[model samples]
Target: MSALDAKKIAEAEALMGQVDSAPDEYAKAGMYFKAATAYRLAKSSDKSKDCFLKAIDCYENNKSWFHAAKSYEQIILLAKENGTLSEVEEYANRACSLYQQHGSPEAAAAALDKAAKMTESKHPELALEFYKRALAVVLIGDATHQASEFASKVSRILVKLKRYEEASKALKKEISLNLQTKSYGQVGRLVVALVLVQLAYGDLADAKKTFKKWGNRCEHQEVSTLQKLLQAFDDGDQELAAKVLASPFIRHMDVEYALLSKNISMPQCIQNGI
Candidate 1:
């Protein structure tokens, strides 16, 4: 390292020594936090993470939950920058829980949402759990927009995981929230999505039941086309199903239609051994 770098590292080490010898909980927490910043300036990421965590522990011991949450949030950001996704998830969740304990449900939900997004690409199941936590926190705070958004996210993840039943359940929660908020537009979309989930699971009866319950509220052309698609699947008419799947209305449903169309086509592909 250069002379200036060495000098900075030594200064950081000295600050860390003071942290270790601090006489009281508050002072120790402050010192550890300062040392963590010093370690970052010295380009020692591992040491920075360690000192931050030590500060978090001290804050927690002293019932300084807000400070602890901030420390965990910093760790999460550092882990993200370092591309340590597992650490990012861990510290984000910790930050979320601490924010919750500190009586900040909005902050908790935001933290959990960040954790969910971080894990979604690499660990969908874990991401689902984080989204659920976020949903719960937002629901508690009556943050309608966040609650609806997180519920939709959870349903999408569950569907991607091929947990169609759970996906339907999550969609139902989203639908309920939309209904409460009188978000008629979103409710219509979620109803279509629910039907798609049911169809993907081969729950034709439930799909029809769901359609009967909520399809009436949707646009006439869209509802009629989806019904025809469902009917084609029920009749095992591959040509008709294919035609219905290709319709502009179904195409507009995007991923939901893709999932249902794929499921409906799978049996025919297997039978024809193609």
Candidate 2:
């Protein structure tokens, strides 16, 4: 090794040793972190990671959640670069927990959301999981408006994945969330989404029950359209059902819902042979 390389590595070793005799947790953490940076500069990546972990431990010993999370963020970037998916997931989760413990739920949620959007196109299912975690983090605080935003995001992704049952459940919960926040105007739209999801999943009975429970909040046009659509299905009037679903109101609701409506093939009728 060159003289400078040897000197850098020796400095790292000395710094790491100093942490053991440090008088305080913060001092120990600083020493370990300095050793980690030196090791990284010397191209000893594994040793750098080890020193980072020790620094994180010292930070945690002092209840320094933000510093611990910052260290984890370094590990997360390394894991991502190495294509160590499981490690990436683990470190990301730890970082989020630490950020939350530091009373930064928005940061926790934004981190997950950023990861989700980055992966949404190629790894949609994983993206969906990330978004769900983000939603949970957002819910940890008193941001009901933020909750509504994430609820819409989660349900839209669910609809795109054609997970109608999960979409229905998400929409139902969102409706309740909106009602609790006195966002009464949103309830009708969410109820429509829930009922549409139930119908798409061939759970007509649940659709009727949902409409009956929340139909009073719907605008007149929505009420008439949904009533006609449900009746068309019950009567096995496939053409009328298609017409109602293809109308501009349904088509322009949202891109996900538009696609979902297009996939709503003619409902099937079960005839009883008496």
Candidate 3:
């Protein structure tokens, strides 16, 4: 490290010591916040995160949840820069929780959503968890539309991860949320996704059942199409299934399902001449 940076970090630690001995929590919060900034100037992100956390403790002790949440969010940014992969989720989760306690559920969800988008490419499973947590945060209020929106995000990540079973479950949850708000059109769209996921998961029986579950909800629009598609797969008719997959409904679905359509094939047992 540069000599200047070393000096700045040392000064930051001294500020921390002063905060520890301070009798007034408000003053401690201010000192810790300054120390956090000093450590950041020193290019010592780990130390910066610690100081922000200390600031959060003091702010929360003074019933300053908004300030505490803002400070905790600084730790999230520092963690993204220097903390371990595991630490990223931990810090983000705690930061969102603090925002929730501050009566800012939307802020909490938005923070996690940003973190998830940033992490999705390199750490999709963790990104999926973040999206799920965001959905939970949104569901804490009566914001049914927001809940449905986040739930769809959760399902999309699960699909991108190729966790078809989990994707089906997530889609089902999203459908339920939409139903609660009488969002029939949204439910219809998710119905197609759910059946597709069930099919991709190689659960023909469940696929049939799921299609039937939404038959009335979808105004029976997808019934015959799903039936023909599912039947083609059932009979191990790859050509027919491939043709069915080419329908505009499959082609125009979400990007994830659209990609899945291109890759769908009969199981190896059938391909291997079983």
Candidate maximizing lDDT: 3
Candidate 1: segments with Cα more than 4 A from true spot = 2-11, 20-24, 254-260, 266-274
Consecutive 10-residue window with the lowest summed lDDT within model 3: 265-274
Per-prediction TM-score: 0.86, 0.76, 0.81
Per-residue alpha-carbon lDDT of candidate 1 for residues 1-274, written as tens digits (9 for 90 to 100) = 7776677678778887787578888789998888887777767789989989899989999999989999988787777777888777678778988998999998898888877887788889888998998998898898997799999899988888888899888988988898888888877767777877877776777878888888866777768777786777677767876787676666677574466655645256433534
- Cα lDDT tens digits, model 2, 118-155, are 56776778778887888888777977888887888889
Q: Which sequence of candidate numbers ranks them by lDDT, best first?
A: 3, 2, 1
Local distance difference test scores for all models:
0.80, 0.81, 0.82
Write model 3 residue lDDT over 1-274, tens digit each, in one string: 9998999988898997887688899889999999998998898887787888888889989988778877866776676667455667876887788888889999899888878876888898889889888888888777789889889888998888888998888888999998998888877767777877887877777877887787678755566677788788777788888888888878888898788777667786654546
The TM-score leader among the candidates is: 1
Off by over 4 Å in 3: 1-23, 219-224, 268-274
Clashing pairs in 2: none
Q: What is the lDDT of residue 36 in candidate 1?
A: 84
lDDT of 2 at 32: 87
Worst 10 residues of 1 by lDDT: 265-274
Report residue 267 deviation for candidate 2 (angstroms). Answer: 3.7
As a whole number from 0 to 100, the lDDT of residue 34 in candidate 2 is 84
